[model samples]
Target: METRYNLKSPAVKRLMKEAAELKDPTDHYHAQPLEDNLFEWHFTVRGPPDSDFDGGVYHGRIVLPPEYPMKPPSIILLTANGRFEVGKKICLSISGHHPETWQPSWSIRTALLAIIGFMPTKGEGAIGSLDYTPEERRALAKKSQDFYCEGCGSLMKEALLPVTSGSASSQADKEAKELARQISFKAEVNSSRKSVAEPADLSGFNHLPSSPEHQQESTTLAFQDTTPNEVSENQTNSASSSQEQHNQPASNNTSMSPRQRRAQQRRVPTSTNFNQVQQPRVNTNHMGSNALILLLVLALAALIFRRIYLANEYIFEL
Candidate 1:
């Protein structure tokens, strides 16, 4: 094992430490790395108690990735266990199928415990899962003891130690059972949340018509429901009222007193009246421009006259 993998590598060191810790077999489960390959391990776990798989000793393969502890390992069953397919990677929270949930703190022992815990639960059509009947599973459990592995060179019956009472293995079994229960509960909660969220997400679009023709008809009905004649009549009435307002000033001017006429002229100007008022400002600007030009021309003429007078005086002096 030392020559097969780099001793300095973290995965190698971790695996070697784990191998030392699990050197002895327990009644519940036992696993060891292959002599030729440190990354590959064979394991045997007793079926969870009081389930269809009770009394079954199932063999399986564990293929650890190069980045073990940081990544999850793959699990494959070899024995004819009714709960999981043979020679296929089983999907579990601790398996490679769910690396997002796998923690580096979890070890091979935790995985074995989880697997034992999972056997009694419903498969729910998950990959590598089987929904075999209880009778079939019981029969398979009886036959699993006779199953042998060519690679491990051990019978399933002899893979683990005999069950003992009040031992460390029993505690491990309890822990496994609890872990499996928690995992199953979490999965059910997540699935329920997804199912509830799906309808809410699609709720907004439900009121919308599904077919194009129905949508077009609804749009048309919306427009038909609005009274265009009333809107046009309102516009027409507003225009006539405004016309009356404009005519009222001129018509009432003859009857108005001097004070009333002055007050009317001081009122805020309408758009047309405002434009008329701005017209004279443009003429005033033009007048200012003409005045400026005249001042400039006068200044230039005065300068020219002064220059001529100086020239004449110079000629007189000469």
Candidate 2:
């Protein structure tokens, strides 16, 4: 009865809390802009150290579902041109396209960290992976520094970075930075490096079923797609075929008797109750003939099956 957008989703909540607590290389490399609308976020990631993108800052977008951890968020590489296709939706387990493997506990920070750690690996044949010459990747990665996503019109300004004064790092930032380091880097990122799987404990988040009303509404919507006229037409066709069969005569030959042919010429309804169900007259000879043919076909099939069984048995004995 009561429906409201779930802004304070558990996954987003935990992610925000953890993100706020983080500082250091992980935080420095990635910045999750926008805290109000948890469903949409833009992140800047520093390239994997010592790689071609080393010290490079990259920008990307993370679009979360209202269901939060219930569904995976889609990740798009906005700044990097290497290995990943720019602007196109990259297939990832953590994206909404695949819910089975996503985890509710996976924070944006975790996804960002894993994404950076994965860069040194080769781009060979991985989902959401792309391959560009090292030169191109590095160039884009360098440009990613100071890159802004203000031009993406659909995104909210509040969800984007606000102008700040003074040094970006503050005093309390130092302690959070130290804590961020203590968290051990679990290689939950797949070999593909484009997705972040939920921690083991959070894998079942999507298993929760929708509300009863949702199911009912979905069924109703599905039913509406089948028009009443279409169904009636199908039913009428079935009835007509049934009547044709009832009126048919018992002839196995290529030709029909005049009376048999006359009955066949009349279109009949398919109802079982020939009189009350509104069908044309039944032809006894045609019914008998059809029954006889069915019986003969069954007999032939049985004989063939029996012969096959005997042959197989003989071969085994040999």
Best-matching candidate per TM-score: 1
Tens-digit per-residue lDDT, 189-255, candidate 1: 7668857865554443345467897667555544454588865775675675576587565646587
Error of 2 at 43 (Å): 0.7
Model 1 off-target regions past 4 Å? 1-3, 167-169, 185-318
Off by over 4 Å in 2: 1-19, 22-28, 33-36, 124-128, 151-318
Candidate 2: residue 152 Cα off by (Å): 9.6
Question: Model 2: how large is the Cα RMSD against the reference?
Answer: 17.4
- For each candidate, give its TM-score against the true structure: 0.59, 0.44
lDDT, model 1, position 282: 34
- Candidate lDDT scores, in order, read 0.80, 0.55
Q: Residue 55 of model 1: what lDDT?
A: 88
